[model samples]
Target chain A: MTPVAPLMLLLLRVTSPCDTGTRVVLVPFERLALPSADARELEEATRRAVAAMPDACLESREDTLARLRGSGDALAACGDAECRSAQASALGASKLVRGVALGVGGKRSVALTVTDARGTEARAQFEAPATAPGEADARAKKALEQVWSPRTTARATREPQGSRMLPKVLWGAGGAALLAGVGFGLASRSTESKLSKNGGECATAGESFAACFSSQLRKGRNQARTSNVLLGVGALLGAGGAVSFIWELP
Target chain B: MPLPLRRTLTLGVLLLASSAASAGPAQVHYALIVASNTGTEKSQAPLNYADDDGARYYELFAPRSREVVLLSVLDAETQALHPGLAAKTRPPTRPAMEAALTRLNARMAEDRVKGDVPVLTFVFVGHGKRGAAGEGAVSLLDGPLTRTDLYARVIAPSKASFLQLIVDACDSYFFVHSRGALPVGPAYAEAVKGLLSDRALARYPQVGVVLSTSSERESHEWSAIRSGVFSHLVRSALSGAGDVNGDGKVDYAELRAFVAAASQGIDDVRGQPDVFIQPPAQDRAFALTDLKDVSSLGYLLVPTGLSGRLWVEDARGIRLVELHKERERPLVVSLPVGKGYYLRSRGREATFSITRASEVVEAGGLPWHDVSVASRGAAQDAMRDKLFSVPFGPRFYQGYMASLGIPQPVDEAEADAALVP
Candidate 1:
């Protein structure tokens, strides 16, 4: 018993239960006063570092870029956090990481910003000087570690399961649907009002009202048709939001 | 024979004899635990924990005792103290209790025939009062049990070699002294200690008595301790914290000293419990309990380093064991420990196991309930609600328990010896 006591005690130490469930997407880092190759190298190195993190699942850069189209240049200017957040939600990511490198010649000052579903933003800035030809990867990795080291990784990746943004997505889409419906309703009302005001003009005899009356009627019909489509879509979306609310927990 | 072999044989024999004295087939324990929350109609408030306390006693004692009887109108949600006696639970009427005693008498007679010493313990966890005629009477479901009746019908007829009686209630000092119910006054408290040297109770040499009140003040209840203050102190003392000699056994004297020391630190005078124990008039300490007697217990090792008060409850939230532990005096519980045992210390709680006898379950290794992010208000409210559920609770700490013979709080270091918090 005495000989095996240490072995037995060692076996009893507790292990961590599970991961924090934070998925991150690193949008390509913007290059400033650096060659395209250097920027690409930096982004690739940082992506690898993030992918190596045991607690984070890195979203594919390609898919992120494709989804974030027109939300400003993905690398050059990542735009406001709301745009980046929307892109993250649209890309099915719980967290977004954007980086920008600023410096002339070889050395660069790189700033990395990570945002979560709860609108929480964490930024890390470090100097990543250009080293030997193959040393770029090592320097990039070292800079990333110094700024966002594994020692502090546990605190950074909270249980951001994208729960915060879920309600917003559901309600936002629902409200958008309703707004389209209201616009269509107003268009229908306007067309009806114009037709009523032009009632005598269309009814007048031999005033070449055939083409004009038909045209007015056609315009009203188009407006009414578009209004109906918008209203129908809006109603379906609102109903969808209600159904979602009844289905999933907050 | 060689000297070493002869000495070894002698030591082995002593061990066998010691085991025989406490357990080994030569002895049997029979307990009649009466936990009644409802007293006679004249009583002020019905006790909330009386029935539960009785159940807790059963949980603690029934497993090791040869035979046990519980008489109470148990709540529907009341958990069974032990599996075997759940079906045998009966109401707390005097006739039914008498019947249970009759059956126990027969069993004791059989044990006597078998040449076994029956260690009989009678526990009353309920209310008590002094009648208008000036006699101490324990309130029953039907009526008051007078002091004379207790001796005439119960104690005098007892056939066991040793008798242990524990009464946790108000005005209980009159049990055997033939004294009338004592009232609350500044002077009476001083005179109550005079009973410490009384010859009348001293004559009962064989009977060990633990009474909760020495004067009119109560045997109160405290939610922090969970059990009635008097009973909880006794139970905690028996759980090994009372072993002042560093020996693993707690006799009646040790328990008395421990209870006195522990209850002395209570801040409110009302919260002080006036405890009285009848010391044996002979040489040998009446070893009330052996902490190592885990033959029927789920042994819990509260390992070294952990200090402060700790409590355990079952899955049904029935409190099982509570003890104030210190480093030099680590506590090991014989309560039925297993999967559902919720261990609480310093307001933090966790679940632990004794699934296997070979396993030495470390107390600190268990998965604890996360209270770091939980609201302090909600936690406090929950404790308040739980405490409030027991009747006569406010009366417990509002000067109900304070009486003569109850000591004032000592320094913090001395206070740590007892269950102050």
Candidate 2:
């Protein structure tokens, strides 16, 4: 039987449902003036980015920045300056995210910046289409995906460990023990059959003393019965363990 | 007494009387054009009130029948094409319409000279069918104006000694009541005739009269005859035929004769003009002129005098309170039964009754009688006699509505939102 071990338990924790480790925050467009190749292309890029990070959680909030900036107004008084400051603060979120979308250009531009909020320099940037139609939605999705990778990868890795491993190990050990018990019980039955077949000649020589024979028969039968009981107990224990593990699932 | 002293004393007495009369009661001209029961399927017929010449002439005329403060009542809901009837999206009929009437009325009352006022006219246009067995005569849209409803709502509060009514519609004569027994019919007759009788005429310091397109038993045309009857006659008169003195402009007396001859299915034209007083220079006459032809005095008088008064009435009516003008004196009276209704001497009050028949409660708070313009948008329309201001741009409404989070009908909100921002 496999022994319950701490190393295995630690591995299970890493793969547990509760340990989806990373988080992300999306920042609003800082510069209204930006050049995008085309609105449609920009939008497509944004959609692709978000779609790529299916497991990521994206949160874009105006109020959070409003409160931080000490103004109830959504569009802050300093226009462009306010936008930049708000975007910066949003990117520097507690949750680790890849980057922030920094809007730039007069007509349209997808010079969006995706930087590690933790180790980012001021105004980290990326290049794409400028002034593309339908770019706004696409860009939003793109920005969301770019910032959500850490959390998504962590969640993907954690899924199988919690759902698959523990139940299989318990059932496999119990099944092996039950099989060994059944084989031992069958071997005892075979030995008793051979002795009985030797009969009268075998009884005079030494194989058939009544007391000894009775004791030997009783011992063999008892061993066989014990093996049968062990097999039943192991099977029951395996089933029960499997059920308990399933019930404990997060 | 010597002859010289007696003559001198008589002249002095006459001078004193003239001076005293000048400082007496204040008088103003008021007129109304109530177009209801016109059997056009919609809430109102489109541009039918305007003359064929492009200018809305009927809205400016109709005071010649008898002069006074004019109050025009148009059935906007029934006249305006609703969603199911037409594909066009029209304006909502509510406070905006009532507000226009009150504004006109108040304006007239404020800028009038003090003296004997002329007759007040209420012209109604729409489908008019005779009364049912127990249900009084009704308009095409189910709830028609009753005779009693017209008097208390229009005549009494307007303070004009004369009440002249011209109903332009098929079978408009059905509104006229001569019965001496029924509660509503007799009351309507008495209130209207009271303005004409030597007694009711004497009670007022002015003249009063009520006229109809047809007599009690006749029917008129809905399209040409009733629709353009008022404007056609006025336009002809204004075009110089009624200018008896050949001044290229028709006066009150001349226009009156013109309308008398021009009206189709003519029934009865009644008036109780004052026989005692000599005619004043402007014996309360109104004429229609083109809005754009300023050089020709080209202003079509869209139902005169009720704009300002109507505005006040609208505000008061919505609140279900009597309008009391700070500048005008209250005309209070005691009913034979129960406590009589008192006209508020301040604030604005409308004297129209909104009846929920099933509930058996008649509320005199809304603009029961109003005018609708077919050509002009609601804000600029001068249908019946009510003058409506031009509508502010749609952007203005979009911005206003956005602030309140109410969805606007126009797609211009995107552009309009920029303005508010």
Candidate 3:
């Protein structure tokens, strides 16, 4: 009925939720059955935490409360994305944040939901020791982190897809073979070059020369053999790739 | 580059990078490749493949040469609005060639300032004729360049320690010799003696020369090679086929022998190739190219056991190089390397690394990609008069890149403007 309410609906209907905008309306936290709490101020603490987001601009307390009061019992209590989206559409806001808190035993648990016009919603919950004062704000930070995470946004739109493991296994095997082949091939060439310059046999002049000559001969032979095997494995994968390529040939 | 003033402007895109000097290991190579198909106003017939052969030279030297520039007159077929063609847009006149040389010299000057060694080579493939004064002159796009002009312009100002001049044309022997045309048997000896007496070349310690003709004869063009007979033979020699001693290096003797063998079993004349080489106070062979150094030189590793002769093709699917391996020979032979070449033999196509890096691309690791078979005649038809013909090759590009791409430019000015970021 209000003129601004109709204008807000036009904005919400035209603009996508993907655009970065600051339109957050938080209906202050409420207890399960009490019209008002005689105890500590929990709603104000929740409001402070949600407003801390870099892209968030909270609605005036008077406007948010007046809209909530008009809803009466038909949809007075809303917790789902559809219900929250409707509330945001009417206010021409981009997002609506709503939450509840309760106490059991020595701990108090809190839950919050943030919904946008795209029918996407994210929720976060946390529990803290109720014996301490100001636990609402203390637990608010943790709950807000869960709501703002990229994974949470992805989870709302689709089922998390899992990657196939077989291709990864093949890639790992091929990469390992290539690494081993290069290492052994380099070692074989280095030793061959050295033995070509100096005689294969050790000189009588020094122990280092003699040991180096004997060591290179054996090591070079071993490396040459190792290099051949690794190269063979790499070739097998290349052949496999070739087969797949041929399958698609015209 | 589109130049507004010329009749048929050829692109001479110069891609240069200032490389760091790591003591003496790094040597900057600069090349000026010129190809002129049209002759002077009233003299010679227009050559069919002159500019294309120049492009072939550009492709061959690209992998090894760092600072490469092309000075050519590209026809409509090869130009295809290529983005690389820009700068000094005039025809290959004497002044145009001089301007190109000046730009290259200024670039190499920076390299010398950075403590890097410079090596320069001049390659010209075109018409050669005798001027009215009886002096030998090679055709430029707009005119002819005389021998005296060449000495004064190309060689005199070059500061490179190692210099090579390769000219493939009818009257090329006149560049260094006093004769107006290539000479015959005993006259060839006299010509060499005359070249040795030249004062300017004698002052240069390290210099090598390869002239296509030794006597006044037609610079024959053979259709089989798709290039002039002399240049094709010389290129064939550089492909390791000329390494008669299996020394892994193609030197002056090896190249001369290869050219002679091509004309073997003939009637009266042997193929004539002239060489004038002087080492820089060192008696090392005038090694033109190395086949074994894959890191510096482009090479392909062909395994021992491949049956039949292996034929290689360029990126355009045009067969260019060939190889045949026997078991009695070494276990592997290094295949001649160029940019974007394919190995095809017996229905099998080889895929290997051609990047300028140290990794050895083993024969065993080559991936075989299946391709649709075309008849031998179709393969032969694919070779002539093409620019960037790899579209029919195995890359099989589906034509997708960025979401918003610039449309192809319509004119030279727009083409140059599109190159800007």
Q: Which candidate tops TM-score?
A: 1
TM-scores of chain B alone in all candidate structures, in the order given: 0.75, 0.36, 0.66
RMSD of each: 23.1, 30.2, 35.3
At residue B177, give the lDDT of candidate 2. 41
State the DockQ of every prediction.
0.01, 0.00, 0.01
Instruction: Please identify model 2 stretches exceeding 4 Å from their true place.
Output: A1-250, B1-32, B36-101, B112-121, B129-142, B159-164, B170-177, B181-212, B215-219, B222-231, B245-256, B259-421
Instruction: State which docking tier applies to candidate 1.
Output: incorrect
Question: Could you give candidate 1's per-residue lDDT for residues A161-204 as a string of tens digits?
Answer: 55435545767776786777678668767766766875545766
- Give me the chain B TM-score of candidate 3: 0.66
TM-score of each: 0.51, 0.26, 0.46
Error of 2 at B247 (Å): 6.4
Clashes of each: 3, 100, 6
* lDDT tens readout by residue for model 3, B1-421: 4332221221111112113212343456777888888777565677777676776666556545665677887766445422345342346677778888998888777777867767787888888875556577788876778888887788778776567777887757666455534454435543564456454556655667777754433335544345665676566556554554333566665455445444332233433343333333332465665543322333443322233345566665444554333321211223323346667655678765454321223342355676765544532333221111121100111121012131322222222111111
Interface RMSD, all candidates in order, equals: 31.4, 27.6, 37.3
Candidate closest to the true structure, highest lDDT? 1
lDDT, residue B140, candidate 3: 88
Q: What is the CA-based DockQ of model 1? A: 0.01
Candidate 3 C-alpha RMSD relative to the actual structure: 35.3
